[model samples]
Target: MPCGGGESLEGDAAIYRQLLSISGHRPKVVLICARATELPCEEIAAALLALGAGKVETLTLGARTDGEKPAFLETVENADAVLLLARQPLRLSTLLGGTSLARLLRRRNAEGMPVAGSAAGAALLAEHMLAGGESGPTPRMGGVMLAPGLGLSNRIVIDQGGLLGDRLGRLLAALALNPFALGLGLDADTAAFIGPDNVLEVIGSGALTIVDPADIGHSNIADAAHNAPISMLNLRMHVLVHGARYDLDFRRPLG
Candidate 1:
C-alpha cells in the first residue's frame, strides 16, 4: 500500500485493519523510520501499538554503525509486516539502496510479506522514484526528477500528497518520460492498496488520481528545452474517491 502524506491515525484505520488482517491478526510489525529524521521512535511506536500491532519494532537506518546493520537486517527478516514511515524518498535510497537489508526486504516482499509505505516511503516502493520537482499547473520538460528506487513495484510510479501538494505536474512529467508506466497521484489522507495481481483499491477520505499516458499521441518532451512547458495530447486521467478500485495492468477503472 502507498499512502499520501499527512494520514491521521484515525483516518488510516482501514489501512491498519487491513494490515492486521493480512498478517492473520496482531502480527509482528517492523516500522522502517530511516527517512524520517525528525520523528521519534517512541511516537511512531506508540501509534502502532495503539493500532493493535502485537509487536512493533523500529529500525533506524539513518545513523547505524557497521556492527548495528546485522541486527537491523535480522529484525526485518523476522517481521510479519513492514511499514515504512514518512520521509524524503532520496534519504531512503541513499541509506539503504544496496544494503543487505534492502535485499532482505525485497526477498521478503516477494515471499508475500506485507509491506506498506507512506509518503516518501510510498515513492521508494516503485522502481523509478520521483526524487523531487516543482509543483505547478502545467507539465514541463524538466519539472520532475527521477531516481532509482527499492524496486518493490515497477508498474506504477507514485506521488504522495498529490492535489493537496499540487504534484500533478510531477506525476505527468514522470508518465511522459516513462510512458509504459502508470502514474498515481495520492492526495493527503489517501492510499492505494496494490495486490499481487496489480489491482489497486482506494481507501481513506481523499482521492487518488491516475495518470495514464499509454494513449498519449504527441509530446514535445524530447525537444523541449529545460524549464519549457511541455505539450502533450491524449493523456488520460481518472479520479478515484474512497472505496473505488482500478487495475494497473489493464489501465482501467474496476467497478
Candidate 2:
C-alpha cells in the first residue's frame, strides 16, 4: 500500500503501478470489504479494471447470504492479489478473526499473493494492531489500545487513524507498550507498500511516520500514573514522504 501528503492523480497512478507490479501484471484482484454494509466500491473496482486487472471480484463477508462458505476460500486461493477497503480495522478483525476466510487470506499472502489495504484497512495487515484510541497531543495512559492483527505483516505495528490530526501521542503509546514492533502512523491518503525484500515504499500525497523503539534507554510506561503522560527516552523516528524507501531489516532509509 502507499501513503503521502494529499491524494493526487499522480499519487493514485503511482499506487496502481506498484500494485500492478506486486501482483504480477494484469493480476486477478480480490477486493475484500471489511465492513458489513456495501462499501461503495464501484470507483475502486472501475480503477482496477481500467488498469487492466484480469478479474476483479468483491467478497463482502457479512452482507452475503452464503456466509463463510468454502467457495470463499476458493475465491481467495484463485486470486493473484487482494485489497481491503476498511473503515475500522478493530471491528473488521473482530468479525474475521478465527474464521476460515481470515486463515485463507493469510495463507494466500504467505504463498506470495500481493495484499494491500487502504488507510484503515492497512491497520490489520500487521501483527501488532492499534485497536482503538482517543486522539491527543501527548502520550498518556489509556489513550491507545493494541490488539493482535491478521498477521499479514509481523514486524510492524500499524495505526491508521487521526494521523492527519497529529496522533503521534497515540502511536507513541502503542510503541511504549509493544516496544518490539515498529509503529507506522499513517495519514488517510498515505499508502505504504512493504515488499518481500522488507523495504517499505511510501506512496500517495500524504506521509507516514515510522517509530523505532530499538534505541530506547528508559521508559516509564509501565510505572507511569494512569492517564498521565509517559516519559520515554531515545525513541528513534523517521518521517517519509512519497517515493522515499526504508529498509526494514536494517532500519535505515535507502537512496
Candidate 3:
C-alpha cells in the first residue's frame, strides 16, 4: 500500500498490517524504487524495516547500465518478494520489460513471493505496458505495449484516479491504437489485484473502473500505424465497487 506521495509513515505502518497478514507475519519484502530520485531512499528503507520485514533493500533500476545486469539479477533472485513503489513514472520499452526486477516480480506466483506495486508500480505489472504518453493527430511507434507484464496484473492498466474529464476519451484513443488492452481506472487508495487465475479483485476504499477492449477486431496493428481509421468496436467496461471481484480470465461480466 505505498502512496503516490512516498512520505506516508502512517500508510506504511498500515500497509504492514496487510503484509504481515499476507505473509503470516514477518515477511521479507524487497522494496524496489528503481526510478526514485524525488524521495530519500534511506527513509523508505527505514520504513520497510519498521514494517516487520524480515529483510528489506532498495534498488535504483533507472540508473542501471547494461553492465550491471548480472548483479541486478542476483539481488532480485535472493529476495522473497518485490514491492515496486510508484514514486516515479516508468518507461517499459527502455528497460526491455524482461529485466531482472520485472522478471522476478513475474515469478512471484510460482515462487510463492507476492509482488505488489501502486500507481506506476501497478501499471508496470500488466500484460501490456504503456511506457509514456505521446501526442499526435495519429499514433506513432514512440509508444509500444509489451506482452505479459511482470504478470502481476495480466492485461490491464491501473489508472489510479477515476476517468474524469477527457481521460476516458484519451483511453479510448489509446485502445484505437492497441485494441487488446484493458484500461482500469482505480480511484484513490483503491487497488485491483489480479490473481494467478486472472481474477481481478478490488481492495481498499474507492472504486475500480475497468475498460475492457478485448472484443475489438483487428488483423494487425500495422494498419493503425498508418493512421487508418479503426472499424466499429465494442468496449466492455466495468466499475467494480469496493470489495467486489471480477473474473478477468473468462471475460464474462461478473454475476
Model 2 bad stretches (over 4 Å): 2-11, 35-38, 63-67
In model 3, state the lDDT of residue 226: 41
> Per-residue lDDT for 1-255 in model 1, tens only?
888875466676666677777875778998887635654556656766787789998877755342148788888888999988756888777777777777888899998898888778889889999988988767788899999988998898989855634888888888889999998988877889888888899988889989888889989888999989888799898999988999988899999
State how far residue 224 of model 1 sits from its true place (Å): 0.2
Error of 2 at 201 (Å): 1.2
Off by over 4 Å in 1: 63-68, 162-165
By the lDDT metric, which is better: model 1 or model 3? 1
Writing each residue's lDDT as its tens digit, candidate 3 over 126-238 gives 55554444333323333333334455544555444233332454445556555666766655556665555777666665566777788766434455544343343566777
Of models 1 and 3, which has the larger TM-score? 1
Error of 1 at 17 (Å): 2.1
lDDT of each: 0.81, 0.76, 0.55
Give the per-residue lDDT digits (tens) of candidate 2, residues 1-255: 523322443446567667877787688998887545334566677777888788889877674333378887888889998887777776567767768788888888777888887656677788777777878758888888888777887788877776545678888888888888888888756688888789988876677789999888888987988888988899898888888999989988899
What's the distance in Å from true for residue 145, model 3? 8.1
Write down the TM-score of every candidate: 0.93, 0.90, 0.71
Number of clashes found in candidate 1: 0
**Between candidates 2 and 3, the lDDT winner:** 2
